[model samples]
Target: MNAEIIGIGSELLLGQIVNTDAQFISEQLSTLGIDVFWHTVVGDNRKRIMEALRLAADRSDIIITTGGLGPTMDDLSKETMAEFLGMELEIHEPSLNRIQSYFTTMGREMTDNNKKQALFPKEAIVLKNDNGTAPGAIIEKNDRIHIILPGPPSELQPMFVNEVKPYLAGKTVDEIYSRVLRIFGVGESSVEAKIKDLLQKQSNPTIAPLAGAGEVKMRITAKAASRQEAEKMIVPVQKDIESRLGNAVYGYDDDPMEMIVIKSLREKEMYLALAESCTGGHVTDLITNIPGASDVLLESCVTYSNEAKVKRLGVSEDTLKKYGAVSSQTAYEMAEGIRKISGADIGAAITGIAGPGGATRQKPVGLIYLSLSSYGGTETKELHLSGNRLRIKEAAALHLLNWLRLSLE
Candidate 1:
């Protein structure tokens, strides 16, 4: 069934608060095979809310609203909805009792205005709020269903999960399942080009490509009676995409590049050390953020200055003078030196000129060199990236981590 979410609060339009409720409800509805066609945000004004309700009723089978269920004078969702639906607002005694009990348990006095929260449309299914005073409701008129939920996430989330999900599940016949494939070292356009044929011939499952800061993601979605059947339908498509993309596709879903690298290191029983320049220990920070990182990471040194490079990482002063700090030779020496000094199985180094300054005629800003030193051999890569200093640093760190991930494979 097609649904529309109406976020009723002036704070959303004024940018005072983010409408995270829409995102949460959309995701939950997707699992029930309900397509969210639109999201409408209106202020607490009764006229605007009534207009939004009229529009939602015309185009959507189910209308879910959040916010404006409170004791304040401006709370208007229930009143506006009742007026539009030609229904009478009546006191739900059970809900009133719950609200009174909540205030009593908290050792607070119940005001008369708080009773406004217990009012609902006649013949509406009252949804109990365990966390707050505002009780929600489900009103069915004609063929359209209107679900009113509280604004606070703490109250809305539980009410939806405990009350609304079961109600919607009974009406749905199919489930929508999605899987995300994470890709690095490839742009969004290139990924789309590789999967052009799959996109053209897609039927049951759909393929969508989304680009992030330094990575691309392909989401595969399928609809079936059961999740197992959906998985069966998605396997061949996933195999095709993986075969085409090869190793550029690093991990899946929520696996970050550093997590993948740490996992690979743990599996191979290898320890690593890092020597960072313009990245300023960002790569090391990413690695340490993951749990169990101590098992794989031996040491990390931020050798920013030429003196530190030479003294801490054992990078040769002669190499720095001859090839410059951002050169491949300096990167190689730094990696070899760190591996030797820390006694790690592998050492990775990043040297870059990620700045609005420090550019020569030949070496411009965003020029980066990455090197890896291992027992087998030493490997280095040069990248010419373009962006602000922060973007350049992030992209350079991601590239170095991806290189390490591929080497471990």
Candidate 2:
């Protein structure tokens, strides 16, 4: 079934709050095999809400709305929906009792206007809100279903999970499942070119490529009678894409580079040390952000200057003098030095000129050298990237992490 999510609040339009409810609802609906075609955000104004409802009802089989179910005067969602659907609003006695009991249990006085939370359309099915005072409703008219949910995620999420999901599950026959393949070291264009044929002839399982910060995400979605069946359909397509992309496809679904790297390090029972230059401690920071980092990360040093590199990471002064700090020789020395000093199983280093400045006659900005040292040997890579300083730094960090992940594998 096709669905449209309408976020009803002036705060969303005013940028006071993000419309995360729409994202959550869309994800939930997608798993139920409901296609979310549109997301409409309307202010608390009645006319605009009515117009949005009209548009959604015309094109969508299911319309889900969030927000404006509160005690204040501006809370107009229920009243507007009732008026638009030409239904009479009546107090649901059980809901009214529950709201009163909630206030009483909290040692707060219940005002008369708070009773407004219990008001629902006569023909509607009331949804219990255990987390908040605003009770939601589901209205069915002329083959269209309107689901009204609270604005607060804490209240809305539980209500939907407990009350709405089963209701929708009974109506849907097919289930949709998706997997996101994360790729690094390859540009979005290259990824698209590699998968162009699959995209052109896509049908049952659709492939969508989304470019992220310093990475690309390929989301493959499939629909079947069950989630397992849907995932089974995606496996061959995913393998085809992976075979074409090769090692550039790093991880799957919600796996970030750092998480995968740390997990790999832990699995191999290897400890790592890092020596960072132009990226400062960003690579280290990313590694430490993952849980259980201490199990695998021994230490990290931010050797920003030539003096620091020589003093801290034991880089040879003669090498720095001959090839400069951003060279492959210095990177290899730094990686080996850190590994030896920390007694780690592996060492990684990144030296680069990530800049709006610091470009010389021979060396340009975004010139990066990455090195990894292990018992196997030491390896180095040269990269010429382009972007602002922050982007270059982030991209450099991502590249190093991907290298570490591949090495571990």
How good is model 1 by TM-score? 0.87
Q: For candidate 1, lDDT tens digit of each residue in 1-409?
A: 8999999999999999999999999988988889999999999999999999999999999999999999999999989989999999989999999999999999999999999999988789999999999999999888999999999999999999999999999988899888889999989999999989999999889999989999999999999998789888888999999999999999987889999999999999999999999999999999999999999999999999999999998888899999999999999999999999999999999998999999997899999999999998888999999999999999999999999999989
The per-candidate count of clashes, in order, stands at: 0, 0
> Model 1: which ten-residue window has the lowest total lDDT?
226-235
In candidate 1, residue 252 scores what lDDT?
89
* CA lDDT of every candidate: 0.94, 0.95
Candidate 2 lDDT, tens digit per residue, 1-409?
9999999999999999999999999988989999999999999999999999999989999999999999999999999999989999999999999999999999999999999999998899999999889999999998999999999999999999999989999999999999999999899999999999999999989999999999999999999999999999999999999999999999998889999999999888999999999999999999999889999999999999999998998999999999999899999999999999999999999999998898896789999999999988999999999999999999999999988988888
Worst 10 residues of 2 by lDDT: 355-364
Q: Residue 37 in model 2: shift from native, Å?
A: 1.6
TM-score of 2: 0.88
